[model samples]
Target: MVTEKNNKGNQISRRSFLTGTATAAAGFMIVPRHVLGGKGYTAPSDKLRVAGIGVGGKGESDIAEFAKGPADITVLCDVHDSRAANSVKRFPKAKFYKDYREMLDKEHKNIDAVSVSTPDHSHAIQAMAAMQLGKHVYVQKPLTHDIYEARMLTEAAKKYKVVTQMGNQGASGDGVRQLMEWYNAGLIGDVKEVYCWTNRPVWPQGIPWPTTPAPVPSDLDWDLWLGTAPKKDYVNKLVPFNWRGWWDYGTGALGDMGCHIVEPPFRVLDLGYPESAEASVGSVYVDEFKQGYFPDSCPPSSHCILNFKGKKGKPDVKLHWMDGGIQPARPEELGPNERMGDGGNGAIFIGTKGKMMCGTYGISPTLLPTTRNKEVNVKQTIARVPEGHYVQWVNAAIAGYGKKEVSSPFEIAGPLTETLLMGNLAIRSYDVRKPKANGNGFDYPGRYIKLLWDGPNMKITNFDDANQFVKRTYREGWKLGS
Candidate 1:
């Protein structure tokens, strides 16, 4: 995407921009300032004109945070007017549209960046479209609904040459940096095991889909809301929030919390793709005696183990992820009264020398034996993001791609997202059912199997059926393309 604009009133045509330019080849804006203007700017567009695609709830606050910096939210788009109301009211000068496609077509020339905070399903398409227009992008956590989309976005960021950041604010927090410093200092020596957990799925899960369809909200464009997911009737509680349980839209708990919780350990260890993944999920019963299959929704809880390759001579590392209220065993070093992971969500790193932990958003980092948090005075070797996640992206966009660094750019977030989603892939694979030849019962071959991964190729080497979850087919009308 285009980052820096030309000064001194240099002009370029749409054809020149859509095609290519020598500067674009070198990570500069192909479209000059004269070709894109509005909102009271001169030859050099000093202010970043950001257009929000999902300007509701989290989105409303996302754009609001952007506006706190040198950005003008030029357009607000949401499928539901009721949902977009707060943002619309907040930015009265910004134009409002229900369809992002129309907003982009009409407002592309005016927008310098895009912040996409839509559901997991639409994230790929909205962010892809914006990137294609040479606009910088700040996409929300988990990056995309599927591994394939995350991989695509990672490559697209480099291909488009835009400043990009995934919405994992914790990646910029001081707590994570402290953890990194401690690890680097060998306070946590040769970390071989990591545990991250969350109490998510505050929305329903491991349940059947709502059989009766609810009337679509009058102000909501239901079709647009569904985006890339297969056509389904609108149901109550799916809008505004509570879509986390369903596979067709949300990616369950792992996708929702993994990026925020896993980022700390991932960055500290400088980890990459997992070599293998496996899961043991909480099962739901049909009544009291029989276990039933509900592939439509995610399991209520799960424990996933993702094995990663260690450095040349070191032993492998195992990262454990637990959600739906499941947590790892408390460290023996801590007293019984001490809270584990801020009571519900937290991460723990176990190394050869010592252990360390942190709460959600990587906040309140602590060393085990609790008192050591103060006794061990590790120097702050890593730089902290004073501007935080949102402003960091804005400044980077202003500085242009490759000029400034972002904490969770697609290059980093893509593999991180894929790693977390591998757990979900195992969970989904665990539910795949096949009938027995005798026709007496069914066999779930996917269960109790370790999925070997070829991360570079984005495939499940051991389970072909499980590979289906790696990518998804969009609904007829939507497309995630260049």
Candidate 2:
């Protein structure tokens, strides 16, 4: 029974199977699905079995969308019980676990795909583990905590041949395609500068951590939530959302919204690594006379500039990222009362001939002068993702590895995440203060320096200290790929 008959309907001997001559001499062993059920007919067992990690907040929505496709939510994992409460009710049949590690280990064979919606710090390790198990993964935006982790996960997705997508849902939106189409048609005339801004860090930033530690919530697993982050006492109001302002747990404004706002320009410009990066961060005034840096937290505001070498025959491009309510001045072409960049989070491209802008998720794309939007007609060259981002991954996972294309696969999202994190590197470097030689005060060593970057090497050639942020040393027992 181990050996089956081949295409000519001839029975294949064990010798033929061992010699790998089944295709040549005896023909194929496994029957094609079309032969059994006709074309395009999927069996019940063909439904992709999916697991959701950190199934709360955005995770809740992500899993629900996947459930709409040919997918079955088989498991859910979260560090906090309350966060998982709603998702558990939504998927009554799905098993729930507190630790993703245990769930993956126990149900590896049963699970076909994983959706990682954890915080920035834990994203890499969780996604890598699933990919290593040959499970397709859909990770949340800003794919990883550090540049090295992003690079590693990008390579792992390819090596494992698993379908992968980042939760930058905007990547799948039609707006970006329109932007690309317009750019290709030379409507923007070789963009030389891009401005992306967001009013984020809506949580606390540029402030000290609570001096008094608060007791961990009864329903939350503090240790598991910390994951690879350095051990620290629990602080009230830090969990769930406030962690976005902390360097150890989150990546500030850039990580929170850059992936969505900056993605269009990155795609349209075909930008890779930045040649150099520099930044200026706004400081918090503790009092009328005192200003503080609060190195542990992200600054209240920042303006980072990254220079990218030109592609093809275009000129070099300079990208400006502003966050924490800072925004670029209105372009002259826009009407006086008209809004810029959705009034809060948006992206604007400045080219030799014209300008174009869009809001978050690359939605609401418009050209300068407003009237050009209606007048300029461009053919859509890029294909749109059907049913949008979540379903895009759902269908791709069911299609198996390399069978379907995903919009933000790790290969593309990784470098994009790295590009955004580079702005953070510059921001963090801006806070690097050292004792002065005169001993009178401290000097900010990292300020005003244009840090040269070597993308392939993932290092700052001019600043050795800045390289430390490129990859962090995990807490002893917690390693990426463990």
Candidate 3:
């Protein structure tokens, strides 16, 4: 993500040489992985020292995969001891801490890279803190909670000159490469529209916020787990998971599955920022014959349409996102017996000449009418990620910033995340309520209105209230930036 300029004579700046006499003399705190006394592999001392934050659930598996690469899992940090139990048991010798701030403050020198698999809310702050310390960072997908956080982290990666990879593993898969190859070969022609759908919120959503106070678990630090989110009473079933429904914490289904499903067309078409966004969200029933407007939680289902600006004589593309079990219409070319987009979650590209579809992680891609898949042969133009996503980051970190290429680097991921989050902004704005002058129920001006966006300015030009979702104010004691 970040590149260092070379010197005119040596072609080696402080970072380029990895670990030469000049690099050592420059006093760089973190050391890149360098081969030692081995022709094929690196010694233990030369392995990348990685510290993992949120070492639970996805975080647990993330570090485990990194360890399979050229990495040594040296430290594990988690707000909940119960969730991190498996990681701790596996990495018995690795240091453990409850606070990421304390871990980075005390052990930044000991670790060369940091892996963040925390909730969406805390991603920007934690990753930013690591990059500022000159640590190569691998952060989980939907990169950050808000659009501004995504933008900030993208800029910081370049400014800090650190290698960075987002956790959209599908971006590194052979499936996406295959899709790119077919599109590049004119098998899909020029895609004018795209559809990505998911059956998410397999957690609760479209409901009233829980008010009943729940006892905080003894093994968890409640305050630490609520990092960057607005503080309140601990609710039932809020921790470990299910927090994806809350606006104060999660980005709902878009943040949950967008990175995987959207990355295929995004890479295939080389998409940039969108020019506008609009959404239609499904409502919940608070009582018989009455619709509920729960701004605190995400809707049960939503369909968002984002219009991207065309370039170089190409027509503007409309990217559609559906979630909470909502899906686009099945293509007529396919038979009734054939499956549509892996049944529950998948994406479809509607092009001028033909259509193609893929399932989650961009797997099982095929052309329309099923039988055409065998007729069209696209050469493998892009190299495959043999080591997979997690290990790709490990290898890239070991090779130093801008040395080895990585899939879903911040340069590509930032705009993708902002594009997805734009849908969220539209959904949130749909609930923007104003009291009627007659003191009646309310008037919702934001509902059913297209939000013109200025991507460079990071604003919703037509709607002022919608801009609030672009950036959220952090709670006290938490800050993110240089």
Candidate 4:
């Protein structure tokens, strides 16, 4: 019953509240004067001096990358025994820790940077601590589990004067850079609406209610896995990867893939935040076995529609997100014969003049215009979309590369993440309201609710009740900046 509406009945309006203080906000720290020019200075280049937390699964890849060539990996941490073992094998000299705080404290002087590849919920706490210690950070996406945390991390990166990078590696891709060029150059004209869709059931779609007590793996540290989250008995249903679909630990398909799929549009358009968000989910199978996957929770298998209106930019732009293994109907722009892959987990920007198409990862993006419509030839973007994911980050970390700056810095990324997270809220509200998965609950299939964001206050004016979920209460020791 509780929604965004305030007790005073004042509604929130979505507006541009950022100070355009991107550079000032980040306070980009250059190599110190002594390190840069003084004769007595010694560079900390014996290796970049790296440490990693959550070193398993995706975290393993992060560790390996930081350990390549000229880096001294002095610290490795993971709650899981097997994952930590494999990482230790790769960098035998590195000290290992089950608690990241201990590793950071003991190895503080030896480490210059840290890579965070933890679950969605824990990103803010770990990243903030590293930044507070004057360490540069590289973290995985969706940057934080909620809008409030994303903003906090961005601000902390600024206040601490540390270089920060989110782990949406596709934002570093050449294809996405070129796609942004095309969109910005008006090759697609003034784009008003974009459809970012994907087919991502690989983590097991359509759950039919999980049963109790499958043996917990010895390798997994169940207590730590539930770090900062509510405690519950360990169950087999949420392990390996399927935790994503449930509301307790994950954000369903959109939360899982939006960072990758939405990167191109967010950067090219300079999107701030959305005016409204709503959803129509497929089905929610309830069971006692499933509790606490997605915090502030929502049902699984949903189609959500998010609408963005301009408070300072152009006009309103609508983004339709289809997942839970669903694909968008083929765009009319494509010839009837020319078809795309069925796993339609990509974005289509329907601009005023033409349309731009991009794959899920965004690098292998392409341009497609209707044969009947006028065609415009524009200069290709020279950002040089990378050939692969790891290479881009590795090159950046090595050469300290590029003149233009990384594509998805928290400035551009933070807003995009805010928009994507709205889908999570929509799902939660839908479950509370008990809306039909199809359009049956309201007059329309997707109902829209306007929200106003006060960037300075970090409050949502229109939705007072929803603001409670905007920032979650972190468990005692796991609090951010502690």
Greater-TM-score candidate between 2 and 4: 2
lDDT of 2 by residue, 87-148 (tens): 99999999999999999999987788899999999999999999888888999988998999
TM-score of each: 0.90, 0.90, 0.90, 0.79
Where does model 3 exceed 4 Å of error?
1-45, 430-444
Error of 2 at 423 (Å): 0.7
Report lDDT per candidate.
0.82, 0.83, 0.82, 0.64
**CA shift at 222, candidate 3, in angstroms?**
0.8
What's the distance in Å from true for residue 212, model 4?
Answer: 2.3
Best by lDDT: 2
Query: When superposed on Cα atoms, how far off is each prediction in RMSD?
Result: 7.6, 9.4, 6.6, 9.0
Candidate 2: list runs displaced more than 4 Å: 1-45, 430-443
Ranking by lDDT, best first?
2, 3, 1, 4
Query: lDDT (0-100) at residue 289 of candidate 1?
Result: 56
Task: Name the runs in model 1 displaced over 4 angstroms.
Answer: 1-32, 35-45, 430-443
C-alpha RMSD of candidate 4 = 9.0
- Tell me how far the alpha carbon of residue 168 in candidate 2 is from the true structure, in angstroms, after superposition: 0.7
lDDT of 1 at 353: 91
Of the two candidates 2 and 4, the one with more favorable lDDT, higher being better, is 2
* Candidate 1 steric clashes: 1
